[model samples]
Target: MEKLELTPPPAILFALEPLRAMADYVASLAPASQPLPQGDGHPVIVFPGLGVSGYATEGLRERLKELNYEVHDWEQGVNQWPDTEFDGFLDLLSEQLKRIHSQNGRPISLIGWSLGGVYARELAKTHPKLVRQAITLATPFADQPNSTHAGWLFTLLNGGVSPMDEALLRRLSIDPAVPCTSVYSPSDGVVGWAGCVGTESEYHRNIEVDNVSHWGMLHNPEVLRVVARLLAEHRRGTFRTLLDTCVTKLL
Candidate 1:
């Protein structure tokens, strides 16, 4: 496989994040007046992106809660890259997943944002029986980690460690054993959009939303609508590609 370098978005486009966030916030409000599919009270865990706490995902978690899902935040404080071979952070996350699964008496759904999505996919692969499904927002697991705008920051935080170490990158490219959805935007300012595509499988899908910034994903109404519909389909025991769902909506 050819090595891919980080392809950051244009500075001008990246700079529009704040404005896009505001627009998304305004658009998100409109979803309240529209009918949304109700959730089935299944447990869903929301993971924050790198260097952020649960606060980063509060809007999304609240929306999922409003839709009647039992949602939990990954309260593990700021998510730092693992420093040890054992990966204590992932171990802690694993324990949390098992705890949540045992407590709910059912498999849990995982929603990861950016780096958190990478974690979600790995967790599902390791603990498939404990995961109902995995959903990722702008996660770049399919490409070299340096292909993200945050790559420099990640390297700095990890004592100049490279995330593209052969073994780790290979693992990231493998498909998880559970149903997966990757929500990505071609205009994402932080990570290369091509890096976010999930492995194609009978249970995996890649959904593209136009003109949304990476930061705005949490508040984007269109993204939320897609999530809501997917949750509803999961609840109904129906498996449909996002393309199929979009076609149904057009009809």
Candidate 2:
């Protein structure tokens, strides 16, 4: 099947992120989904999206904690350019992954939202032995980096795309060595959903939910259930489409 062309979401729709976020807050207060799988107490690191701080992912980390996974937030204050300072954030990320992997004595799971997903995928590829699986939320990992409304902002920050930008985009599109899951919604108000769901295979899969705007992917209750299922699937086997997800069923 031919993939849809990538484009920024409509301005009217994109403006609803705050509304969706509000809805997520209300929905998360009351559990609506059926029983979700509990985690095996493995470590999972969640990376925040571009231009945001770890506070944005606090709800997501809390939900994962309820599943019994050791969840940690990216310590870098506010997310900025990957190559910003201190030998770059990726290096910092690598060190953190190594420390966590060493202390836990088990591979860790990487979950990233939007730009954070870019980090999760890259780290998994670079250090598969240290990673059990990877999950991305509302991330545009496809080749067309300029497809989102905020794409230009990124370009401006990076001082225009260079060879490094091209290389990173190429790497982001590639699937990680470990099991990978992408949770996205067609109604996402930020990045286009087409690029959010990477290529699906035995180890790589996509879960599409309803009513989750790009910003809401972090706090959306349905998204939490999806993550819980994927994390629980680690012990049984690889993640697949037929995971009894409440995402499609309830959403």
Q: What tens-digit string does per-residue lDDT give for candidate 1 at 4-110?
A: 45477677767787887788788877736567789888899999898888999998999899999999998788877666553566787899899988888888889
Q: State the lDDT at 250 in candidate 2.
A: 41
TM agreement with the true structure for every prediction? 0.90, 0.89
Give all candidates' CA lDDT scores: 0.80, 0.80
TM-score for candidate 1, please give it. 0.90
Model 1 deviation from native, Cα RMSD in Å? 2.7
What lDDT does candidate 2 reach at residue 61? 90
List clashing residue pairs in candidate 1.
6-147
